[model samples]
Target: MPDFKRGRSFLRGAPAACLILFLAACSGGQPSAPETAAGPTAASTTAAGAPAVPSASGAAPPSSAVPGASSSTRPALSKEAQMETDRLLIRAAKANDPVQVRKLIAAGGDVNAKDDIQDSAFLYAGAEGFNEVLKLTIAAGADVKATNRYGGTALIPASEHGHVETVKILIAAGVPVNHVNNLGWTAMQEAILLNDGGPRQRETVRLLLEAGANPDIRDPQGRTALQNAERLGFTEIAALIRG
Candidate 1:
């Protein structure tokens, strides 16, 4: 079997149904640059710390979850209520605020809410290394395989950052290691092309390779991970890929 499907597991306790957001999932490299805020982020939060939620009464957004109300009498918020909750979720994710993320989820926000640019709270959490926030979104059932505006999976950006841990988390959650983006590059290819080709990125490449990423996959200009690593003087990484 190809390495791409070798590890078919997820972190224990996270729902394996796995809703993916495109991302250690960051797009190119560290998002600390001016364009940093715009591309890639990923996460894998364990639900071990999930706050206890109530039953029917507390399980829904406050707008709809009126205490002591019968089913027919239950006061449901209009669509506006859900929209507001989703907006708050986006803000919390953008700010990397796990507490706010948890609260919003408890209040009935969608884990898969996407912003105007097609960035989702879940995607931002992953791309930004917001571990706790990412987990909360996942526990709330984030679409683990969600796509970004550029038609890339979350794993592409995550690998590019040399975020080995985040990449591991995402892969465990079932993000494909070899998925190609609209730019026609795989996660492995992006790791070399967009990074410093340092130890961090090397480890990321190692992880992806171990997870079954195809090193032979190329970018738009026909450069493979090995070629990118070699041309950029990442001799050690290039050698590793060659083997």
Candidate 2:
């Protein structure tokens, strides 16, 4: 077989099915960002760190998650309650129901709760191209940069799934486009690896390059974005960057 790794690479990041698995494996892996007081300022908390809140695009403003029965004096959650809450939040995200999602979060459903497979609401929303859900999660303080077990971040998932809007949201939220995962793959690398070169991918590349992602930046093996695009026959992308 020809060496596909160099040029037209296939996505090696976590698969859609495996997303949940990845999140579960690394649930609550990082310290959530310190909570901020209510305000119009665009700051939200998540496991990875703080990212700015997305501007309301006519979508309902995100309702704050109410501190649930688990107050500062409350004990830890029982297994069943935790599972139920997880199910509810995941369903809300999948259904694209921001109100229900906020309710779940207010109830103490982890904004970044991972399923059995380690998929969090943010990951699922990004992967499914649910822009609204992704925004709501971000506003509710979801971790924008949390990496999955496969070393996939929300940016990786959004790019892989061809969710341009989600990708933009992630970028606006300050996700590092050139950020590399355990596999030595950046978000741009993942886009090329997945053979995704639609307008979204092009925009993603443009965003990364403009944001200081050196197209000349090489991976562990010294492969550049141009090299990958050229090898994959992504002439448009190569041309865009070469310009």
Candidate 3:
């Protein structure tokens, strides 16, 4: 994990449109002030299997259970009802209301249900830096590594937002640190490109590195983590990588 510094001109003009898209996809939609509301976002998806909470180690039953269906006679939630649930989950997530969320999960809300844009409940929680919501979703069986339409995983979004605790929770729970998206960006890459390389972001790089992210790992553009660091003028990060 290294940091590179680029001038304001480079920072403002660098053609990282695709990278921003990738980061946006991974980081849960767009930039917003941290929300204290408890609800899901427009990107949640229906969990596919039995909705069981994840274990302390992050393992959970498969996502195959149909929401609102009994084992013998389970029927899927109506589209309208499902939509409302999605909204509730997103709001609850933003609000960090784990209690209501638990109630929804117990009542057969689709933990994996995607909002209109295909974002999962877990992704929304991760993107918004809702630690409690994220843990509740994961414990309730949301996919920690699930990618949205742009192939962004929960781990990716959490990392880009510099949510160190969230990222750590995801990693310790088995999210792949080095997992790449369609744009060839990894969690480590996201941390470097953020330009806001504070201690938490630095810690993110350290985590990814210790998790075995290759400091020399190159993106499709032949850019390595060190290169990105230097490009961003993150000298300390560069030094860390060299060390």
- Best-fitting candidate, scored by TM-score: 1
Q: What tens digits encode model 2's per-residue C-alpha lDDT throughout 180-203?
A: 778877777767668557777887
Give the higher-lDDT candidate: 1 or 3.
1
Candidate 3 global lDDT: 0.73
lDDT of each: 0.75, 0.72, 0.73
Q: What C-alpha lDDT does candidate 1 achieve relative to the native structure?
A: 0.75
Report how far residue 33 has shifted in candidate 2, in Å: 58
Provide the lowest-lDDT 10-residue window in model 2: 65-74
lDDT of 2: 0.72
Off by over 4 Å in 2: 1-80
Predictions ranked by TM-score, top down?
1, 3, 2
Clashes of 3: 53
Which whole-number lDDT from 0 to 100 does residue 213 have in model 3?
75
Residue range 127-236, candidate 3, lDDT tens digits: 66777777878877777668877687877877888888888888877887778878888888888886487888888888877777777768889999899998888887
Best by lDDT: 1
Poorly placed runs, candidate 3 (over 4 Å): 1-69, 72-83
